[model samples]
Target chain A: MTTFETSVPAIEPTGSLSDSVKIHGLLAEFETPGDILKAAEQVRQAGYRWWDCCTPFPVHGLDRAMGIKPTILPIMVFFAGLTGLIAAFVLQAFTNSSGMSVWAMVWVTGYPYLISGKPLLSIPAFIPVIFELTILFAALTSVFGMLTMNGLPRLNHPLLGNDRFRRATDDRFYIVIEARDPKFFRTRTEAFLESLGAVAVEEVQD
Target chain B: MSSIRADQVGGRIVDNTTEVPGTRAPLVLNMTTFGQVTAQVAKVSEAGRAPLAWYVAFAGSLGLLGLLGVCVLYLIFTGVGVWGLNTPVAWAYDITNFVFWVGIGHAGTLISAILFLFRQKWRTGINRFAEAMTIFAVMCAGIFPGIHVGRVWVVYWLFPLPNQMEMWPQFRSPLLWDVFAVGTYFTVSLLFWYTGLIPDLATLRDRAKGRLQQVAYGLFALGWRGSNRHWHRYERAYLLLAALSTPLVLSVHSVVSFDFAVSQLPGWHTTIFPPYFVAGAIFSGFAMVVTLAVPAREMFGLKNLITLRHLDNMNKVILVTGSMVGYAYSMEFFIAWYSGALYEKFAFVNRAFGQYWWAYLLMVSCNVITPQLFWFKAIRTSIPLMFFLSLVVNVGMWFERFVIIVSSLANDFLPSSWEFFTPTWVDIGTMAGAFGLFFTLFLLFCRFLPMIAMAEVKMVMPAANAHHDEDGHHHGTPAPATGGPS
Candidate 1:
């Protein structure tokens, strides 16, 4: 393991499985969250952009340790919520207060409903629907935005095929650095991960 | 902890849940491990057969659910006349049940959202099932409103839809606001609950033995690899959902209250209705949670996870919210007298001394008197006492709604319109069936889904602490943290 350096050429890891199968990544498994956190910090320091730490639960500060940036999900949700607010306002105004008409699946017109001779376009009356829609849209967007961003609901993932990596959702911690990463030299990266105190390292396949 | 434990005033054994003043008690007791938490939660779902009690409970619930189905079918075939809906007492058991079930749903959201916001890690133990309860309670609630419409076929008219009638729902109506509010609440709560279920479902997927379990858990698990990069976004989304649900839960009750508050009736028309309803909802919701949780923990062998501390904390919430509800009741009376409104005064007096005096008394006794018993540490921690009290509080809350709706609507200002609201057998059956529906759904959920949030429990484990750099082995004994809920 000490014979290789970071600049070593990309050598395919051998003697683990059939060479015919393509390698997807190198999976370094650790026993506890602390071991993984230690490895993740060093991996981040080494500047591996295409690597990730997998754990049973979210390890606090692991994102910072891995040099991950804050998510832009809130900004996206805010705009989605804003869209809901405006849509609710428009929906209520068009159907209840405004004289304007438009086609939305069918011809729609503002009825200007006069309740007890109260003022038309009651902002106070419109508020509950607006608030509900905003929360509704923002909530739905947060879930879907997260799923879309995370590339979820797929039938399979390469990491799921690795038996040693199965503990990633259990007691063990893992660091998966894909072969797609430029810094990922098959044997050398395995050596680097082993040096970081991984209990067991396995080759993941596509 | 030692100081408190040593000063046993009467030599009575103090449960670990009792306040120790300065020490942080670990959330998980009996030295649980990460793998064990996953195993304990996952095993219940994966077991080939549920226990005999589950079967009995399910059969009974399923029977009640069938009764609910029969009641709905009868009501649909035989109009709203099947129930005792007189002129003035148009809204009796239906609205009461609707509000009661919706109020019960609030506790779950409060646990999962508000507690999460406040960093109450103890919520992790109970949030999954609590959220499940919320969903089921809302489902039960939704049925009443839809069925109560009588012409159930055109119930969609409640929504702003372009129909053959060429008419839209009145957006200004508080009833329409109710439609929007409850709809939004149900959708958001489902999403929030499912989001929390994802990682736990992944655990079930990983541990799955049968083909059916694998495909089912796997599909819902959604290929979640639990990458830290994903966790970053997932956590943020959870935080956002929590932020969204906190206000959403509060708003749902407020909007529901507006259905009554905006009315011309004295008891129904009040500004305090919004906050009062919210507090009552939380109070009743916590009671319902305790009632369900007491048996669930024992039945599923989750006593260590859903500890006495969690129950004690929930009881404290019940006490606080219950006191708030009591205050609102007294305030309503004060306002009625202070405003010099004759109808309002009569509404208050009639509520206590009129035809439905018994219902008002029960509400006050169950909601106000019973919950005050929680002020005692001994009563709060005792499982049996809390469980009984929880059931009592649930009844009290329902009667509270009954007194509010029926009494207000029944004893109208015009004596000619005044009528006593009496529920026929169908009405009683529907309410019972609603419980059956709630429990049936809940039982199914407990049987199929990961009833506890395994991932969340593991996150709070002492071994998960960052300071344990020496933990190269999986079984490294954790040094208990001084960081539990104060």
Candidate 2:
């Protein structure tokens, strides 16, 4: 596969923009990694930084093309789990000790079975319930945190409406040169994408 | 299937190479795929006798279940006296079968919830079937205790409610604790299992041939759209439920153990029972998984996903749990001897060399010695051996319950009360019926439902872009293309 090269011009968006800005950027599809890398390098050489690549499966070097970094879900999950443990402990202590007053009063008044010297408030026995609650909370927090951070429950997306995108479920690859990218100008980016060996390029509207 | 290398791609491949066209490999089949259902059904029926064999098995299980139904009706119409549940053996087959079926149900949670929490991917293939097993087994188990109390109509008395019968189920009673534990376990397991099934059900719904099929699968599918948003929330909710379920798995079994351990019965009272019973529950549960999975995998043409690797993993678990159970058995003996209580010593000794020596030997052989063969790679991987050993473990575990319930009660504190507990036709018949109920439901489940979790299998496929190593984000390859013939 020969690498595709393109040039891109910078265009910063204002709080608002002209209706003439309606010229939507398009996506380029590729069938191989060499094609993507060569196209990315050519686009860089062309001074355009407005393109993205999508595939049915994540390509190993796709991040380099996009300049993305690792996420912090693991660290967030760690702290969330830690918080769950602390919450469980505090909840148990407050509920068992201070909240036992009514139970203590009722028992002392009406039902007193004298056994040996086991205390009425046994913290040790309550540890099992507390441990279970801690794991329960930690698991819930981490999972929910993952969902929220990932932006879930979105029933629809503009991407889903595209017929060509159907292959995303089975086998296909695509890269969109968004107009919002810093070095995006429709004509220049389109020219750059053409040089990058995109089989077909079609504009995606907002 | 042909393998395409990056070198074969036109020019230097792009940064993310696309799919090589016309190379979708056929799905693999094995023990984990169809086992008793598809695989065995595939083999025995291959001589063109499978339909006949299925008919025979179905008819046999149905007849046995019918007999069991008769036995149950007889017991309810007459009394508990239909079984040989005399004074010393009051617990008899009802309690034994109760514990037996509950133990059988344990594998479902172990395979699904526990394994999922551990991030074991192989669980996807087997968890569906195991969860179904858990539900049916629990159904069988729940029946025994419900009718064990003579007035079967008032079994609701165990429920904690304010009513005309103005009495509360004693919170202190282990039996009440059992009610809560079993009920909670069943509900939670059912929810977890069904939640996992929603997406798969949608797959089935879309492919159903008729309206009734559509409605049945559609209702259960809950309108799953396979959208990123639904998946995101579904994943989160599933994880939360799984987390909730993990402790419940341990607590539920521990509570069941307490049913015996909390009792003043000399052999029953032991601190080790909780973990011991839990391990044994898992042991027998895994055994059942293997017994069912091996055949299901083969029959269903799911060998690739449910691969030999999965079978090896399950075998290893069985060996570990089997050993743990063996250790518990020894510990009980040591504690009995060290305590120097005559009753305890007698309970321990009589268990090994007494009149019920056959039961003791069966327990040791099945739960302890039988699983040891798994130390050999051949035995672990060999389908036939695993199936036979699973039966051994099942029979062994049943005897373990028998030895515990009968031996301890038949010759307890008073010698005059000693009597050999014998199971009458009703006792044997009801047990057969429970098996019938279990198989009948299982056979029906297999006929419907995606026997394999199609979406989950696709997720784990090497080509499915489920994981992004750089960003730690898994948009997951779009939902897999469905309706492929096996």
Candidate 3:
């Protein structure tokens, strides 16, 4: 199993952090989605795991090229929805229904008021709340799951230090192979990226 | 390869710039390049200051918002009795406006979530504003129920929280269901809107020249670096949210309909209320979208972006849903007579030919008769006519709620209790204030945010990226390479 890195707390430097720190990675700029996909494939074929492609928008087929496995978001969302459905049912049954005996004494004091002569345990009346809660949980799970899975809200990353890297969100694409990768060698990786037709290659510092 | 022809359809010039081979018409007109799409869309947000007309509209909206605040304060100081709540017509304009505004909110979710899932590319042009309108309209809708509780301070009692009184809110009551439905709808819509806005905000953050703008945009951008890995998760989450919201769009209004449908009221109690209400909601929602978009596109100089085709498409939706609403009207009448239920018969009859007959006529003309004009291509595409008809639809929808609530109640079972309900100054002022609140929030949104989704718009354009081959020749077709070098 390939274990993805979770959020790492940034270590505070004693003095002159930029000067003392090792280069974070090499960011190679590509003009088109095709170029980045090609670069990603080369890096993946070379067995470089600590690498990612950045684009302004999603590039179709790029995931296959980069050898990224399908995410398990749907499974997470499904369980969340089920939890909500059960929780809603339990809540309504406890609050609006009757008869939970403890020992010889009737300990349950549920708010079981009769509405329009309808039965206390009305399943039809409970469906709306169940449906809403199911959706609410599923939707919230999808968002927080995505964020958690992606390790987001970090608010800062070493790649952001590269001035040219800002264009990753606007009219540019990049493939960055981190220094932490096992296959990475400074001169060899730089040459490999340039050979792949990178428009510009720059060192991203921590 | 011929581009511009002398032929004109629906008052729009048949220009070659938008034409795609084998297609009769273009999806987007005059969108030649990716840079033009970005520059045109980003300019609205990055232009340092808005146009004079924006300020004028904003000022007017703010004035109305002030009036709304005054009316709300006065109502809170006094009571629900300040308005027109009597014996028979207990729910006059407050609930009418509540249902009306909530109905208007439906179109935004339908456009942003449903149309998106259906792969309707045209929605890219208007979904941002539509979603924003949904949030604001729901805000307006929430105020009515909040204030309608009579004792505003104890409004929290509506929730099922543990209280000192050892009481829980009645779960079976549709009104309680409404609190959950609307509250959940508002929360989810807000999350969906903000999620969509992140990438666009990042684009704006990259383009911001000033310190304050950069900081503000950057904070909201949430440190987005557009990593394909993040995009992968973002896309999945977005798709799931859309799927979740589709059911919510139906469920929210169905639950709202339940507030009436679950009751034994003559016109209100029917199985058909859910679908009928959903249809009417989308109908009025589309009309409101048109009413806002037509002026917004003109004021923001976004003609090339939000072109006549968008307006024509929305008008088509209005026609379909309006017809559905009309069909519901006829169905109710037919079922009432066919069922031989005297009270239901009286409810339908009293709505049309009774004292509130003029309200019924206005509803029919504005909703049913007026939308019938869209059968003409000229009427569908005409900006002025469409704008006027959109407002007419708004008025018609309001009166539809009025007729359903007032007419049904004012002539219930007992003749002695039947009395006409009339609105005082407070009711009118408060209702007008809701509009003020909507426009006020909208105008602020127009000024601050990227009113159009820049990234999504670029995705739809043909020349979004410049592709070049090894020989340095520009390739018009997508690269045949499915994967990187094997």
**Clashes per candidate, residues 3 or more apart or on different chains:** 0, 41, 1
RMSD of 3: 5.5
CA lDDT, every prediction? 0.88, 0.66, 0.83
Candidate 2 error regions (>4 Å): A1-206, B1-53, B466-486
The value of fnat for model 3 is: 0.47
lDDT of 3 by residue, B329-443 (tens): 9999999999899998988998899999999999999988998898888898888999999999999999999998899889999998999998998999999999999999999
Better of 2 and 3 by TM-score: 3
In model 2, the Cα lDDT at residue B160 comes to 44
iRMSD for each candidate structure, in the order shown: 8.3, 11.7, 5.8
Model 2 TM-score, all chains together? 0.69
TM (chain A) per model: 0.88, 0.65, 0.86
The count of residue-pair clashes in candidate 1 stands at 0
What is the model-wide C-alpha lDDT for candidate 2? 0.66
Estimate, for each residue in B159-255, the C-alpha lDDT of model 2 and write its tens digit.
Answer: 6443543234444446766876787678767776776776566555544556786677667665554433234345556766776778788887787
Look at candidate 3 and give me any clashing residue pairs.
B3-B16
In angstroms, how far off is B322's CA in candidate 2? 0.9
Model no. 2, DockQ: 0.05
TM-score of each: 0.93, 0.69, 0.91
